[model samples]
Target: MKAAGILTLIGCLVTGAESKIYTRCKLAKIFSRAGLDNYWGFSLGNWICMAYYESGYNTTAQRVLDDGSIDYGIFQINSFTWCRHGKLQENNHCHVACSALITDDLTDAIICARKIVKETQGMNYWQGWKKHCEGRDLSDWKKGCEVS
Candidate 1:
């Protein structure tokens, strides 16, 4: 293998180390501090539940959709219309690179998520919420987290 290939391999390893799988309770605290609680009539449970269904709490999660776009981070933010993958940033409503969504630091991810939800006018933008979280008693998501 060439030096570039080796460097790429090392980069992957480092990136993997940079990721994290946060506990539910911890996530509740984080989300609360980040102002996700009832931000748009959606409780903290909604946020926590969506994060679980989207990426199982993993920070480095990435999913490639059928349309050649990808979903990134714990929120599974879509690259097609939300974030940019390469140099093309025209359609990136989140104003962030797709890679920013995968980082353990969720500042950008949270901000972008707000934009996505606001633009769509609701939490219906996330299939996870519609499938597993919506119309359900999501109180357990923040149970004992003391985020309230």
Candidate 2:
């Protein structure tokens, strides 16, 4: 029984590690429905471009930073200021577990992202956006994705 339980837990962990990488159009629709299409004066294309640069649209993507803080999920929300991982001190403005960001469901990520935008310098909070999506014609990001 113990071995069975251990195997089950391992299976679950392995499954969790696998991320869902959304297609650009698919993500555009999702973000549009979530009101992120033009939120904070940025287009849905900007969000899509940012997600690609941040996590390649992989929900389970996580990167441990040089400062020991982890960026989680497709948007790569950070542990240092946005989320709490384990017992680490965090600002936790998102009011969610860092683990929550890495799930297939992006509801929490979208909600937290909204909070970050409202509190900080809008989409500029994501360096990915500034580097790739800003000051560029991002129409190709959602070119054929009719997000109605």
Candidate 3:
């Protein structure tokens, strides 16, 4: 009976873990189709994780500041700054968010992110995600996104 119970618990845990990855994979397709995949070089897996950390992938995400301005979009661009990089739109603009990511050069966001990952988290930090999401198929990303 003890061995059977342990096996059941492990099976349940594995199922839950698989479900989470399925959800993240769906979200990855949305972000990739929206233009973020063009300007960002990180893996869709990593980008989905970052979006979860930043704003739960909410496109209408916004933050209010003491100065009374609004920040908008999935990657969270301040209204004042959005105009500098992208077109104005009633709805959040994914293209603008993508452009802002390339602030200095086309590859700036990816290179900068790698540098940050190294400086703050140390080298090989991305290995952590592989451990966390072990056994998940990230290769499905190619079907959903067109690389720039």
Number of clashes found in candidate 2: 0
Candidate 2's TM-score reads 0.87
Task: Summing lDDT over every window of 10 consecutive residues in candidate 1, give the lowest-scoring window.
Answer: 10-19
Off by over 4 Å in 2: 1-15
Candidate 2 vs candidate 3: which has greater TM-score? Answer: 2
Q: Model 1, residue 120: displacement in angstroms? A: 0.3
Question: Can you write out model 2's per-residue Cα lDDT over 27-120, one digit (the tens) per residue?
Answer: 9989999999789888888889999999999898888799999999999999989987889889898889998999989999999998888899
Instruction: State the lDDT of candidate 3 residue by residue for 63-99, as single tens digits.
Output: 5557654543333344443323345442322223433
Of the candidates numbered 1 and 3, which has the greater lDDT value? 1
RMSD (Cα, Å) of candidate 1? 4.1
Model 1 CA deviation exceeding 4 Å by range? 1-17, 88-90
| TM-score of each predicted structure versus truth | 0.87, 0.87, 0.37
**Compared with the true structure, what per-residue lDDT tens digits does model 1 show for residues 1-148?**
6999998788668555476899999999999999999988899999999999999999888787788888989999988898888875448988898889898899999999888888896889889889999999999999998878
Every candidate's lDDT: 0.88, 0.89, 0.44
Backbone clash total, candidate 3: 0
Residue pairs in clash, model 1: none
